[model samples]
Target: MRIVIALGGNAMTAPDGGARVEDQLAAIGAAAEPIADLVLAGHEVLLTHGNGPQVGNLLRKNELAATVVPPIPLDWCDASTQATIGVTILDALDDALGARGSDRRTTVLVSRTLVDRDDPGFAHPTKPIGRYLTRDEAEPLIDHGQEFVEIAGRGWRRVVASPEPRECLDAAAADTLLAAGYVVVCSGGGGIPTQRTADGRLEGVEAVIDKDLTAALVAGHIGADLLVIATDVATVIRGYQTPTQQPIGTLTAPAMRELAAREAFAAGSMGPKVEAITRFAERGGIGVITSLDRITDAVTGTAGTRVVPAG
Candidate 1:
């Protein structure tokens, strides 16, 4: 099967793993075990992943470097961070496969995605980024025009506009790898969201496109047989975390839509997963969202929230 898996950021970082290189490599190696299995089973795979923590660290690095060197823009920082993550994951997967006596080749594509210049998300930046700052702590930055939002009881954070993705710019390159029998890892952190300027030049935007949604776009573009999103949940639930929560394992698009309308998922969490699943099913691709360990079973049709087209 030609499958595209979206790896969760939490899976890429060990629970106690601070921002150390050793920890990240070990964490990536562990995460690549199941993924390498898919490749060994002769399944064509495309990989995408989250780089929230990685990008956060990169931003902090840029901030620290500002005292010595000029601070680069956030968009450039995001691109650099994703590239670092992609290379790390690819190397770890390659090494793991070799250790297991497999000869599968892995390639990491530094991907870019096209976004609409007029996307409304820019007008309303909602994606929280950078270091979390208390109100007083952020006052200085805010006074200097640093964009921030107060999360009520959770302190303040810099929020970037998360725009909708239009196209995966590296689609052709990734497709080439797929055709050549390589496990391609691309589109990390939603392909470093970019837009075409009025002068027809593509410029990086200071926003993140939802990773799961970008995964859907890649799946649809490649005519994938299955799209698996490995999040932190075993199953998607209606009224999640509440007493009335309903665990749904198999659902049609229409049903998921109705549940979504009722606000069954939290905006910052399950919302993107459900939305990605709906879009994938709508685009004639099958989808499953579940925890990372359940991925093999989910792909074999045994577990996860299996989503199909609406009747």
Candidate 2:
């Protein structure tokens, strides 16, 4: 089966937010094993990952070094993190494949996603980046035209526009790699968030596109049979954290859409994931949501919350 796996950015970093290169490589190394196993089992796979922590770290660095050097734009930060994380993923996956005695290789494509310039998301930045800061520390940025949001006990962090992804500019290249038996990783941090000019030139925008949505787009573009979104949770839970909470198993796209319509998931968390999978399912592809460790099981329908198109 042709599969597309979306790895969460949080999985790329330490639980305590450590961004050390060695630690991240270790994290990705562990994550790469299951993916490598899939490839060894004869399934063609395409991979994409989130960049929340990595890009946030870059943004923080930009702020800290503003006095000594010019800070780069958000789009530049997105590109940088894509390359940084892409290389890390490639290294780890290569090592994992080698340890398993497989000759399959991996590669990364610096992808770009198209978004509308007039997207309402631009006027209202809701995507959070960077570490938490006290209100006093956030005041200076807020006064300088930057947006910050307070997350209850998590303090304040900068927020940016999370526009919807319209198209993936490099999906053809990714598809070609997959066709050549390469475990391809692309569309990191939603493919660097770009838009087109009136003259038809591509321009990077100051926004982030949700990686899950972009994964679905890429899956469709590359004709993937399965779309797997790997998150921290083992399965999607209904009424999460409550006594009535129940783990969902196999569900049809219509059923999942009904639950989503009732706001059964948190918008900032599982909401987008559910939407991404449902969209893919609607298009007649299988979608699964599970933890990184259960990706193989999810593909076989033995684990994870599976979404299929309604009959």
Candidate 3:
């Protein structure tokens, strides 16, 4: 199957994983193992991963060094994380695929996605980012014009405008590579958000696109048969974190839309996953949500919450 796997943000690095390159590399290596198995199994794979923690860590660094060096814009931080994570995925894949003596080429392409400059999300940034911050920790940022939302029973987290992704600029490169047998890792952190000028020139925007949404865009662009979102959870559940929490085994786009309308999933967490998958499912493609460990099975419809078309 032509598959586009969206690796969850937290999976890139553990919550407690320090801001060290070596540790990040180790995490990516673990992630690459299963992905490599899929590749060796003869499925054409296109990889996209989240870098929320990584980008937030970089933002914290920029903040800490503000006195010594100028702080860069948010989009620049996204680009840095993309390059870093891309290289790490490439190296890890090298180790994993090399072990099996597979000669498949792997490459990383820095991706940019187009979004509307007037997206309402910019006015009300609601995407949680970085480590969960306490009210005490978030106040300073909030005071300085950054927006944050308190996660349910969790903690405060910086939120940014998660604009809708309209198109992927680097998709052609990824597609060409995939066509040539490369397990292309591209579109990290929702693909550095960008906008087009009147002359059609592209400029970076100060926003983040949800990785799952961009994964949908990539899946559609590549005409993928399946969109696999490997998150930390084994399956998407309703009434998350509540007494009534229950796993959704099988779903169709219409059914999920009804649940989503009733707010069955947390807006900050599972909402984007379901929303992205719904879009793909509407396109008559299969969408599976599962943990990183169960990605292979999920792709084969053996595990995870699978979403399909409306009968």
Model 2 CA RMSD to the hidden true structure, in angstroms: 2.2
Number of the top lDDT candidate:
2
Model 3 gets an lDDT of: 0.86
Query: Total clashes, candidate 1?
Result: 0
Global Cα RMSD, each model: 2.2, 2.2, 3.3
Candidate 3 contains a number of clashing pairs equal to 0
* Candidate 3: residue 95 lDDT (0-100): 91
TM-score of each: 0.92, 0.93, 0.89
| Candidate 2 lDDT | 0.89
User: Tens digits of per-residue lDDT for model 3 on 1-311?
Assistant: 89999988656775574547767877788899999999999999999988877887887875456556665678998899899889889989999999999878899888899999888998887766666767876666666566778888998877778888999988988889999999988888889999998888899987888899999998999889999999888988888778998998888999989988986566667988999999999998999999989988997789998889997
What are the per-residue Cα lDDT tens digits for candidate 2 across 1-311? 99999999656977676778876887888899899899999999999999887877787776676556666788998898899999999998899899999889899999999999889999988877777888876765666567888899889998889999999999999999989989999999889889898999999988879899999999999999999999999999988888998999999999999988875688778999999999999999999999999999998889999999999
Give the lDDT of residue 61 in candidate 2: 79
Clash pairs, candidate 2, are none
Q: Give per-residue lDDT, candidate 1, residue 115.
A: 95
Off by over 4 Å in 1: 134-145, 150-156
Ranking by lDDT: 2, 3, 1
Go through the candidates in order and give each one's C-alpha lDDT. 0.84, 0.89, 0.86
Going through the candidates in the order shown, the clash numbers are: 0, 0, 0
lDDT of 1 by residue, 1-311 (tens): 99999988767887663657777887788878889888888899999998878877877765555445555666786678778888898888888789889888888888899999889888888778887778876665566455889888888888878888889998889988998989998988888788999999998877878898999998988889899999878888777667997778888888778878987577778889889988999887789998888889989989899889977
